[model samples]
Target: MSFEDEWAECQKTANQRSTRMQLNQTPDGNYRPGRAPGGDLVVHDNELGAIGNEAYGLYQHLRTQGDEARPATFAAATAMTSSSLSLGSALYQVHDNWSTQLGSLKEACAHISNHLDYSQKRHKEDEARIATGMHTVSKLYDYFK
Candidate 1:
Protein backbone atom coordinates (compact mmCIF):
# COMPACT_ATOMS: atom_id res chain seq x y z
CA MET A 1 0.00 0.00 0.00
CA SER A 2 1.06 3.57 -0.61
CA PHE A 3 2.21 5.71 2.30
CA GLU A 4 -0.97 7.82 2.27
CA ASP A 5 -3.19 4.71 2.25
CA GLU A 6 -1.23 3.14 5.08
CA TRP A 7 -1.35 6.36 7.06
CA ALA A 8 -5.11 6.64 6.61
CA GLU A 9 -5.61 3.00 7.64
CA CYS A 10 -3.49 3.53 10.73
CA GLN A 11 -5.48 6.62 11.65
CA LYS A 12 -8.75 4.73 11.22
CA THR A 13 -7.59 1.89 13.42
CA ALA A 14 -6.36 4.30 16.06
CA ASN A 15 -9.67 6.10 16.05
CA GLN A 16 -11.55 2.83 16.48
CA ARG A 17 -9.68 2.11 19.71
CA SER A 18 -10.81 3.52 23.01
CA THR A 19 -8.88 6.39 24.45
CA ARG A 20 -9.04 7.10 28.17
CA MET A 21 -7.65 10.15 29.95
CA GLN A 22 -7.74 10.13 33.71
CA LEU A 23 -6.55 13.15 35.64
CA ASN A 24 -5.67 12.78 39.32
CA GLN A 25 -8.27 9.98 39.71
CA THR A 26 -9.07 6.64 38.16
CA PRO A 27 -12.08 6.03 35.97
CA ASP A 28 -13.87 4.68 39.07
CA GLY A 29 -13.29 8.01 40.86
CA ASN A 30 -10.66 6.82 43.31
CA TYR A 31 -7.45 8.77 43.62
CA ARG A 32 -4.76 7.46 41.33
CA PRO A 33 -1.91 5.49 42.85
CA GLY A 34 0.88 7.64 44.33
CA ARG A 35 -1.29 10.74 44.18
CA ALA A 36 -1.98 12.74 47.30
CA PRO A 37 -5.28 12.05 49.08
CA GLY A 38 -6.66 15.40 47.99
CA GLY A 39 -4.88 15.42 44.62
CA ASP A 40 -3.10 18.54 45.67
CA LEU A 41 -0.71 20.11 43.14
CA VAL A 42 2.32 22.08 44.21
CA VAL A 43 4.41 24.69 42.33
CA HIS A 44 7.47 26.37 43.76
CA ASP A 45 8.31 30.08 43.35
CA ASN A 46 11.74 29.40 41.82
CA GLU A 47 10.25 27.22 39.10
CA LEU A 48 7.74 29.87 38.18
CA GLY A 49 10.43 32.56 38.22
CA ALA A 50 12.60 30.50 35.91
CA ILE A 51 9.75 29.93 33.48
CA GLY A 52 8.92 33.62 33.52
CA ASN A 53 12.51 34.54 32.91
CA GLU A 54 12.76 32.16 29.98
CA ALA A 55 9.60 33.55 28.43
CA TYR A 56 10.90 37.08 28.84
CA GLY A 57 14.16 36.10 27.19
CA LEU A 58 12.34 34.50 24.29
CA TYR A 59 10.20 37.60 23.88
CA GLN A 60 13.23 39.84 23.83
CA HIS A 61 15.06 37.61 21.35
CA LEU A 62 12.07 37.46 19.00
CA ARG A 63 11.62 41.20 19.20
CA THR A 64 15.20 41.74 18.09
CA GLN A 65 15.84 38.84 15.70
CA GLY A 66 12.48 37.72 14.32
CA ASP A 67 12.20 40.73 12.01
CA GLU A 68 15.69 40.51 10.64
CA ALA A 69 14.32 39.32 7.32
CA ARG A 70 11.33 41.66 7.11
CA PRO A 71 13.06 44.59 5.49
CA ALA A 72 14.68 42.40 2.87
CA THR A 73 11.53 40.43 2.24
CA PHE A 74 9.45 43.57 1.91
CA ALA A 75 11.95 45.13 -0.45
CA ALA A 76 12.09 41.98 -2.57
CA ALA A 77 8.30 41.79 -2.68
CA THR A 78 8.04 45.43 -3.66
CA ALA A 79 10.69 45.00 -6.34
CA MET A 80 9.05 41.85 -7.69
CA THR A 81 5.61 43.44 -7.82
CA SER A 82 6.99 46.54 -9.48
CA SER A 83 8.56 44.26 -12.05
CA SER A 84 5.12 42.74 -12.75
CA LEU A 85 6.02 39.29 -11.42
CA SER A 86 3.04 37.49 -9.90
CA LEU A 87 5.34 35.83 -7.34
CA GLY A 88 5.83 39.24 -5.75
CA SER A 89 2.25 39.29 -4.49
CA ALA A 90 2.65 35.81 -3.07
CA LEU A 91 5.82 36.85 -1.35
CA TYR A 92 4.05 39.89 0.08
CA GLN A 93 1.28 37.68 1.37
CA VAL A 94 3.78 35.36 2.97
CA HIS A 95 5.50 38.32 4.59
CA ASP A 96 2.21 39.66 5.93
CA ASN A 97 1.28 36.28 7.36
CA TRP A 98 4.71 35.88 8.94
CA SER A 99 4.42 39.30 10.58
CA THR A 100 0.94 38.51 11.93
CA GLN A 101 1.97 35.12 13.32
CA LEU A 102 5.19 36.52 14.76
CA GLY A 103 3.21 39.31 16.46
CA SER A 104 0.82 36.76 18.00
CA LEU A 105 3.70 34.60 19.25
CA LYS A 106 5.44 37.61 20.74
CA GLU A 107 2.25 38.67 22.47
CA ALA A 108 1.76 35.21 23.92
CA CYS A 109 5.31 35.09 25.29
CA ALA A 110 4.91 38.54 26.82
CA HIS A 111 1.60 37.56 28.40
CA ILE A 112 3.02 34.41 29.92
CA SER A 113 6.03 36.25 31.31
CA ASN A 114 3.96 39.11 32.71
CA HIS A 115 1.34 36.84 34.24
CA LEU A 116 3.94 34.64 35.95
CA ASP A 117 5.75 37.68 37.32
CA TYR A 118 2.48 39.07 38.60
CA SER A 119 1.52 35.75 40.17
CA GLN A 120 4.87 35.49 41.96
CA LYS A 121 4.64 39.02 43.32
CA ARG A 122 1.01 38.57 44.35
CA HIS A 123 1.78 35.30 46.16
CA LYS A 124 4.59 36.94 48.11
CA GLU A 125 2.30 39.79 49.07
CA ASP A 126 -0.34 37.35 50.26
CA GLU A 127 2.18 35.43 52.37
CA ALA A 128 3.39 38.66 53.97
CA ARG A 129 -0.17 39.75 54.73
CA ILE A 130 -1.03 36.42 56.29
CA ALA A 131 2.12 36.44 58.42
CA THR A 132 1.43 39.99 59.60
CA GLY A 133 -2.13 39.07 60.52
CA MET A 134 -0.93 36.06 62.49
CA HIS A 135 1.66 38.17 64.31
CA THR A 136 -0.99 40.75 65.21
CA VAL A 137 -3.29 38.05 66.50
CA SER A 138 -0.47 36.57 68.58
CA LYS A 139 0.30 39.98 70.04
CA LEU A 140 -3.35 40.54 70.95
CA TYR A 141 -3.49 37.15 72.64
CA ASP A 142 -0.32 37.91 74.59
CA TYR A 143 -1.71 41.30 75.73
CA PHE A 144 -4.87 39.58 76.93
CA LYS A 145 -2.76 37.04 78.79
Candidate 2:
Protein backbone atom coordinates (compact mmCIF):
# COMPACT_ATOMS: atom_id res chain seq x y z
CA MET A 1 0.00 0.00 0.00
CA SER A 2 2.89 2.43 0.86
CA PHE A 3 6.41 2.86 -0.59
CA GLU A 4 8.05 1.39 2.50
CA ASP A 5 5.73 -1.57 2.37
CA GLU A 6 6.50 -2.18 -1.31
CA TRP A 7 10.25 -1.96 -0.76
CA ALA A 8 10.15 -4.43 2.06
CA GLU A 9 8.05 -6.79 -0.02
CA CYS A 10 10.48 -6.56 -2.94
CA GLN A 11 13.44 -7.31 -0.70
CA LYS A 12 11.60 -10.22 0.86
CA THR A 13 10.72 -11.77 -2.50
CA ALA A 14 14.23 -11.33 -3.84
CA ASN A 15 15.64 -13.05 -0.80
CA GLN A 16 13.16 -15.88 -1.24
CA ARG A 17 14.24 -16.35 -4.87
CA SER A 18 17.91 -16.42 -3.92
CA THR A 19 17.26 -19.02 -1.27
CA ARG A 20 15.21 -21.18 -3.62
CA MET A 21 17.87 -21.14 -6.30
CA GLN A 22 20.44 -22.36 -3.82
CA LEU A 23 18.32 -24.92 -1.96
CA ASN A 24 15.93 -26.27 -4.62
CA GLN A 25 16.93 -29.15 -6.89
CA THR A 26 15.33 -31.46 -9.39
CA PRO A 27 15.63 -35.27 -9.44
CA ASP A 28 18.20 -36.76 -11.78
CA GLY A 29 17.33 -38.65 -14.91
CA ASN A 30 17.37 -42.44 -14.69
CA TYR A 31 20.73 -43.94 -15.65
CA ARG A 32 21.42 -46.96 -13.44
CA PRO A 33 22.80 -44.92 -10.51
CA GLY A 34 26.36 -43.58 -11.23
CA ARG A 35 25.65 -42.92 -14.92
CA ALA A 36 22.91 -40.28 -14.85
CA PRO A 37 23.36 -37.21 -17.02
CA GLY A 38 24.98 -34.20 -15.37
CA GLY A 39 23.53 -30.69 -15.73
CA ASP A 40 21.87 -28.19 -13.43
CA LEU A 41 18.40 -26.78 -14.22
CA VAL A 42 18.21 -28.35 -17.64
CA VAL A 43 16.67 -31.40 -19.25
CA HIS A 44 19.39 -33.79 -20.37
CA ASP A 45 19.90 -33.70 -24.13
CA ASN A 46 23.20 -34.79 -25.66
CA GLU A 47 22.68 -33.09 -29.00
CA LEU A 48 21.79 -29.82 -27.31
CA GLY A 49 24.85 -30.02 -25.10
CA ALA A 50 27.21 -30.52 -28.01
CA ILE A 51 25.69 -27.64 -29.91
CA GLY A 52 25.72 -25.33 -26.88
CA ASN A 53 29.39 -25.89 -26.06
CA GLU A 54 30.45 -25.34 -29.64
CA ALA A 55 28.42 -22.14 -29.86
CA TYR A 56 29.91 -20.85 -26.62
CA GLY A 57 33.40 -21.33 -27.97
CA LEU A 58 32.51 -19.65 -31.20
CA TYR A 59 30.96 -16.70 -29.36
CA GLN A 60 34.07 -16.21 -27.25
CA HIS A 61 36.27 -16.30 -30.32
CA LEU A 62 34.11 -13.78 -32.11
CA ARG A 63 34.24 -11.39 -29.16
CA THR A 64 38.00 -11.64 -29.09
CA GLN A 65 38.23 -10.86 -32.81
CA GLY A 66 36.06 -7.74 -32.37
CA ASP A 67 33.09 -6.72 -34.52
CA GLU A 68 34.67 -4.96 -37.48
CA ALA A 69 32.30 -4.04 -40.29
CA ARG A 70 34.78 -4.88 -43.07
CA PRO A 71 36.85 -8.00 -43.55
CA ALA A 72 39.09 -8.87 -40.61
CA THR A 73 42.88 -8.69 -40.67
CA PHE A 74 45.08 -11.63 -41.57
CA ALA A 75 45.63 -12.60 -37.91
CA ALA A 76 41.95 -12.49 -37.07
CA ALA A 77 41.16 -14.41 -40.23
CA THR A 78 43.58 -17.15 -39.26
CA ALA A 79 42.19 -17.31 -35.71
CA MET A 80 38.58 -17.63 -36.78
CA THR A 81 39.38 -20.13 -39.53
CA SER A 82 41.18 -22.58 -37.26
CA SER A 83 38.79 -22.34 -34.33
CA SER A 84 35.67 -22.63 -36.46
CA LEU A 85 37.00 -25.64 -38.33
CA SER A 86 37.97 -27.48 -35.14
CA LEU A 87 34.67 -26.81 -33.40
CA GLY A 88 32.72 -27.76 -36.51
CA SER A 89 34.60 -31.01 -36.89
CA ALA A 90 34.01 -32.03 -33.31
CA LEU A 91 30.30 -31.25 -33.50
CA TYR A 92 29.97 -33.06 -36.81
CA GLN A 93 31.48 -36.20 -35.36
CA VAL A 94 29.13 -36.16 -32.40
CA HIS A 95 26.14 -35.58 -34.67
CA ASP A 96 27.18 -38.45 -36.89
CA ASN A 97 27.70 -40.80 -33.98
CA TRP A 98 24.26 -40.07 -32.54
CA SER A 99 22.61 -40.34 -35.94
CA THR A 100 24.23 -43.70 -36.61
CA GLN A 101 23.04 -45.03 -33.30
CA LEU A 102 19.52 -43.63 -33.52
CA GLY A 103 17.82 -46.89 -34.36
CA SER A 104 19.78 -49.00 -31.88
CA LEU A 105 19.66 -46.49 -29.04
CA LYS A 106 16.20 -47.29 -27.80
CA GLU A 107 17.37 -47.61 -24.22
CA ALA A 108 19.04 -44.22 -24.30
CA CYS A 109 15.84 -42.65 -25.60
CA ALA A 110 13.96 -44.09 -22.66
CA HIS A 111 16.29 -42.14 -20.39
CA ILE A 112 15.23 -38.94 -22.11
CA SER A 113 11.70 -39.73 -21.01
CA ASN A 114 12.94 -39.91 -17.46
CA HIS A 115 14.41 -36.44 -17.88
CA LEU A 116 11.03 -35.26 -19.10
CA ASP A 117 9.42 -36.54 -15.91
CA TYR A 118 12.05 -34.86 -13.78
CA SER A 119 11.49 -31.54 -15.53
CA GLN A 120 7.74 -31.75 -15.05
CA LYS A 121 8.08 -32.50 -11.37
CA ARG A 122 10.46 -29.57 -10.94
CA HIS A 123 8.02 -27.25 -12.66
CA LYS A 124 5.24 -28.25 -10.31
CA GLU A 125 7.47 -27.67 -7.32
CA ASP A 126 8.34 -24.19 -8.58
CA GLU A 127 4.63 -23.35 -8.92
CA ALA A 128 4.08 -24.42 -5.35
CA ARG A 129 6.93 -22.22 -4.19
CA ILE A 130 5.35 -19.24 -5.90
CA ALA A 131 2.05 -19.94 -4.22
CA THR A 132 3.73 -20.22 -0.87
CA GLY A 133 5.56 -16.94 -1.39
CA MET A 134 2.29 -15.22 -2.22
CA HIS A 135 0.69 -16.52 0.95
CA THR A 136 3.63 -15.40 3.03
CA VAL A 137 3.51 -11.90 1.59
CA SER A 138 -0.24 -11.70 2.18
CA LYS A 139 0.27 -12.59 5.82
CA LEU A 140 3.08 -10.09 6.10
CA TYR A 141 0.76 -7.38 4.80
CA ASP A 142 -1.70 -8.15 7.58
CA TYR A 143 1.07 -8.11 10.18
CA PHE A 144 2.44 -4.74 9.13
CA LYS A 145 -0.96 -3.09 9.51
Candidate 3:
Protein backbone atom coordinates (compact mmCIF):
# COMPACT_ATOMS: atom_id res chain seq x y z
CA MET A 1 0.00 0.00 0.00
CA SER A 2 0.99 3.66 -0.43
CA PHE A 3 2.00 6.05 2.31
CA GLU A 4 -1.49 7.48 2.77
CA ASP A 5 -2.98 4.01 2.93
CA GLU A 6 -0.42 2.97 5.49
CA TRP A 7 -1.08 6.10 7.49
CA ALA A 8 -4.83 5.51 7.46
CA GLU A 9 -4.29 1.92 8.54
CA CYS A 10 -2.14 3.10 11.38
CA GLN A 11 -4.89 5.46 12.44
CA LYS A 12 -7.44 2.67 12.31
CA THR A 13 -5.25 0.50 14.48
CA ALA A 14 -4.87 3.25 17.02
CA ASN A 15 -8.59 3.92 17.04
CA GLN A 16 -9.29 0.25 17.62
CA ARG A 17 -6.80 0.12 20.45
CA SER A 18 -8.19 3.22 22.06
CA THR A 19 -11.75 1.96 21.82
CA ARG A 20 -10.82 -1.39 23.29
CA MET A 21 -9.04 0.34 26.13
CA GLN A 22 -11.94 2.66 26.78
CA LEU A 23 -14.57 -0.05 26.71
CA ASN A 24 -12.78 -2.56 28.91
CA GLN A 25 -15.04 -4.35 31.37
CA THR A 26 -14.40 -7.17 33.78
CA PRO A 27 -17.15 -9.66 34.57
CA ASP A 28 -16.42 -9.40 38.30
CA GLY A 29 -16.91 -5.61 38.21
CA ASN A 30 -13.51 -5.06 39.67
CA TYR A 31 -10.32 -3.55 38.31
CA ARG A 32 -8.29 -5.84 36.04
CA PRO A 33 -4.60 -6.56 36.40
CA GLY A 34 -2.32 -4.02 34.74
CA ARG A 35 -5.39 -1.97 33.84
CA ALA A 36 -7.77 -0.50 36.36
CA PRO A 37 -11.47 -0.85 35.69
CA GLY A 38 -11.61 2.92 35.57
CA GLY A 39 -8.38 2.70 33.60
CA ASP A 40 -4.95 3.42 35.00
CA LEU A 41 -4.94 7.17 35.22
CA VAL A 42 -1.26 7.40 34.40
CA VAL A 43 -1.44 5.00 31.47
CA HIS A 44 -4.60 6.57 30.14
CA ASP A 45 -3.06 9.98 30.52
CA ASN A 46 0.07 8.87 28.73
CA GLU A 47 -1.87 7.31 25.89
CA LEU A 48 -4.00 10.39 25.44
CA GLY A 49 -0.97 12.62 25.60
CA ALA A 50 0.86 10.52 23.04
CA ILE A 51 -2.07 10.43 20.65
CA GLY A 52 -2.45 14.18 21.02
CA ASN A 53 1.22 14.75 20.33
CA GLU A 54 1.02 12.55 17.24
CA ALA A 55 -2.03 14.33 15.95
CA TYR A 56 -0.32 17.66 16.49
CA GLY A 57 2.73 16.50 14.60
CA LEU A 58 0.58 15.08 11.83
CA TYR A 59 -1.27 18.38 11.56
CA GLN A 60 1.98 20.30 11.32
CA HIS A 61 3.32 17.99 8.63
CA LEU A 62 0.09 18.07 6.65
CA ARG A 63 -0.07 21.83 6.88
CA THR A 64 3.52 22.06 5.73
CA GLN A 65 3.17 19.63 2.82
CA GLY A 66 -0.50 19.37 1.91
CA ASP A 67 -0.71 22.62 -0.01
CA GLU A 68 2.60 21.98 -1.74
CA ALA A 69 0.80 19.83 -4.34
CA ARG A 70 2.68 16.64 -3.66
CA PRO A 71 1.49 14.42 -6.46
CA ALA A 72 4.67 12.48 -5.82
CA THR A 73 3.24 11.22 -2.54
CA PHE A 74 -0.56 11.27 -2.62
CA ALA A 75 -2.11 10.45 -5.99
CA ALA A 76 -5.34 11.98 -4.74
CA ALA A 77 -3.65 15.34 -4.83
CA THR A 78 -3.98 15.30 -8.62
CA ALA A 79 -7.77 15.74 -8.71
CA MET A 80 -7.78 18.14 -5.77
CA THR A 81 -9.02 21.65 -6.38
CA SER A 82 -6.28 24.11 -7.13
CA SER A 83 -8.08 26.59 -4.90
CA SER A 84 -6.22 27.60 -1.78
CA LEU A 85 -9.49 27.44 0.12
CA SER A 86 -9.86 23.76 -0.57
CA LEU A 87 -6.32 22.99 0.52
CA GLY A 88 -6.73 25.27 3.48
CA SER A 89 -9.89 23.45 4.46
CA ALA A 90 -8.09 20.10 4.46
CA LEU A 91 -5.23 21.55 6.46
CA TYR A 92 -7.71 23.08 8.85
CA GLN A 93 -9.25 19.68 9.45
CA VAL A 94 -5.90 18.46 10.64
CA HIS A 95 -5.53 21.51 12.84
CA ASP A 96 -9.01 21.03 14.26
CA ASN A 97 -8.33 17.38 15.03
CA TRP A 98 -5.12 18.32 16.75
CA SER A 99 -6.84 21.03 18.72
CA THR A 100 -9.44 18.60 20.01
CA GLN A 101 -6.81 16.09 21.02
CA LEU A 102 -4.75 18.79 22.70
CA GLY A 103 -7.23 18.89 25.56
CA SER A 104 -6.30 15.35 26.50
CA LEU A 105 -2.63 16.26 26.32
CA LYS A 106 -3.14 19.24 28.56
CA GLU A 107 -4.80 17.01 31.11
CA ALA A 108 -1.83 14.69 30.95
CA CYS A 109 0.46 17.65 31.37
CA ALA A 110 -1.54 18.74 34.36
CA HIS A 111 -0.99 15.32 35.87
CA ILE A 112 2.71 15.79 35.32
CA SER A 113 2.56 19.21 36.90
CA ASN A 114 0.87 17.79 39.95
CA HIS A 115 3.44 15.06 40.31
CA LEU A 116 6.31 17.44 39.63
CA ASP A 117 5.03 19.85 42.25
CA TYR A 118 4.13 22.53 39.75
CA SER A 119 7.67 23.26 38.68
CA GLN A 120 7.63 25.88 35.98
CA LYS A 121 11.08 24.82 34.90
CA ARG A 122 9.96 21.25 34.38
CA HIS A 123 6.92 22.35 32.46
CA LYS A 124 9.05 24.51 30.20
CA GLU A 125 11.36 21.58 29.67
CA ASP A 126 8.44 19.42 28.69
CA GLU A 127 7.30 22.08 26.22
CA ALA A 128 10.73 22.05 24.66
CA ARG A 129 10.59 18.28 24.44
CA ILE A 130 7.27 18.53 22.67
CA ALA A 131 8.62 21.00 20.12
CA THR A 132 11.63 18.80 19.51
CA GLY A 133 9.40 15.75 19.20
CA MET A 134 7.27 17.53 16.64
CA HIS A 135 10.34 18.41 14.58
CA THR A 136 11.62 14.86 14.79
CA VAL A 137 8.30 13.49 13.60
CA SER A 138 8.73 15.10 10.19
CA LYS A 139 12.13 13.53 9.82
CA LEU A 140 10.79 10.17 11.00
CA TYR A 141 8.11 10.07 8.30
CA ASP A 142 10.70 10.55 5.60
CA TYR A 143 13.21 8.23 7.21
CA PHE A 144 10.74 5.37 7.69
CA LYS A 145 10.74 4.77 3.89
Best by TM-score: 1
Query: With candidate 3 superimposed using the best TM-score fit, by how many Å does residue 96's alpha carbon deviate from the native?
Result: 20
- What is the full ranking by TM-score, best candidate first? 1, 2, 3
Instruction: Specify the highest-lDDT model's number.
Output: 1
Ranking of models by lDDT: 1, 3, 2
Q: Enumerate clash totals for all models, in the order shown.
A: 0, 0, 0
TM-score of each: 0.63, 0.28, 0.23
Clashing pairs in 1: none
lDDT of each: 0.82, 0.51, 0.52
lDDT of 3 by residue, 55-142 (tens): 5555556556544544332443333434433665565555556555655565554555455443444555665685577558746755
Please identify which of the two predictions, 1 or 3, would achieve the higher lDDT against the true structure: 1
**TM-score of model number 2:** 0.28
Cα lDDT for residue 45, model 2? 48
Candidate 2 local lDDT, 1-145, one digit each (tens): 9999999999988766533221232333232322334423433345455555554555455445433422323344455557875555555554555444543344344455455556566766875796588568757765764
Model 1 residue 144 lDDT? Answer: 62
Model 2, stretches more than 4 Å misplaced? 1-104
Error of 3 at 81 (Å): 14
